[model samples]
Target: MRLPCIGILTISDRASQGHYEDKGGPAVETSLRAILAMPFEALRRCVPDERPVIEAALSSLCDNDGCCLVVTTGGTGPAPRDVTPEATEAVCDRMLPGFGELMRMESLKQVPTAILSRQTAGLRGRSLIVNLPGKPSAIDLCLKAVFPAIPYCLDLIGAARLETDPAICPAFRPGK
Candidate 1:
């Protein structure tokens, strides 16, 4: 089987500048590695919380790098620097609002501050981009909530086919 190409982007001014360690990006990588049973490769990037930079990175990953799925961490809060969602919307061909809604809804069960999160997901060409919060625990929570449909979404977008371990993350697809 061909390996799936995935992009992992971390949007944080401090982490990008090397002022702080990036916990969220690694969390995403670990989660994907643990759950995805298919052959896959990840292209990782760390950038500051700037809309233009994020937009450029997203475009390059989806268009140039040929990443079927681009998962971004950080810049989903109410802060002015939090423009990951805006950048994602700008580059994507369509918005998948259900992802953000479901993430927030699931996270609300954990923390009341989930209302402040603006996590979102979208599609650019054949690539699916998901904006996630910076916190590592929040990453785990959000991924668990929405990842069941991600593989199928990528399949529908003509990007790649992703198979998951049923015991770890049983993906929900019709006629499974």
Candidate 2:
């Protein structure tokens, strides 16, 4: 059987330029390590906040690399350059707004500025793409809030089956 594969794309001009570290990507990786019960690989990419570039990377990860899931960090704010969600929407076949709703709702508990976040999730073919906040702390919180449903979402979309560590995050599979 093939091990499940996912992509982690970090969107940040400074990080892409090497002026800053890509903590958000690693934070996602760490959460995956803690939450997943099976083996998987995370293909990482760092790029500036360019819509075309983000779309291309997301496409390449899902279509070319055959990644069943792609999680993006950053570029979800209201700034003019924050376009990850738009890029995601453009490339996805269907949009799942509940992911963003739950993320913002969970994030709002930590900081009021979570309202400014526009992170969203969508399905591109068989791959699932999710936009997340850039902050490392917020990434963990958002993942915790939304990941319980990811495996089932993947199942519904015909993506790879991802089992979660019940001790860390028990995936909800109805009638399982």
Candidate 3:
């Protein structure tokens, strides 16, 4: 069977320009590796915090590359350049607001500034696009907080089936 294709997108001005090493992309891969029980291919990309660039990358991943899920890190902040959410919203046909809401609610337990996060998730074609904060720690936290619903969401969207390790993050699926 062909492995499910998943995209790891890192949006950062410095990382995309090679000025700073990209930790968020790898961080997302690592976290997913630990949480996912099924085999999959992780396609990684780094782009500057430009809306057009981010949107194009997202389109390529979902429309061209056929990524079942695209999880992005960075550009979800209050900064003017933080446009991941906007780009995702533009590319996605339907927006899933509960993801950002749950992530923020969970993150608020750790830091008061969690309210500043603008993380979100949406669906583009059959692919699920999720936006996450830039910090590696926050990436892990937000992913864990929201990933429980990811598999079922994929099932609903007709993407590739994704299962999670019960020891890491047990996925929720009704009557499964």
Candidate with top lDDT is 3
Q: In angstroms, how far off is 44's CA in candidate 1?
A: 0.7
Candidate 3, TM-score vs. the true structure?
0.98
TM-score of structure candidate 2:
0.98
Scored by CA lDDT, what does every candidate get? 0.93, 0.95, 0.96
Q: Runs in model 3 with CA error above 4 Å?
A: none
Q: What TM-score number comes out for model 1?
A: 0.98
Residues 20-50, candidate 2: write the lDDT tens digits.
9999999999988899999998899999999
Q: Give the root-mean-square deviation of each candidate in angstroms.
A: 0.9, 0.6, 0.6
Which window of 10 residues has the lowest lDDT sum in candidate 2?
1-10
Tens-digit lDDT track for model 3 on 1-176?
A: 88999999999999999999999999999999999998899999999999999999999999999999999999998999999999999999999999999999989999999999999899999999999888999989999999999999999989999989999999999997
Model 1 C-alpha lDDT per residue in residues 1-176, reported as the tens digit of each score = 55789999999999999999999899999989888987798999999999999999999999999999999999999999899999999999899999999999999999999999999999999999998899999998899789999989988988888998888888988887
Point out where model 2 deviates above 4 Å. none
Q: Between 1 and 2, whose TM-score is larger? A: 2
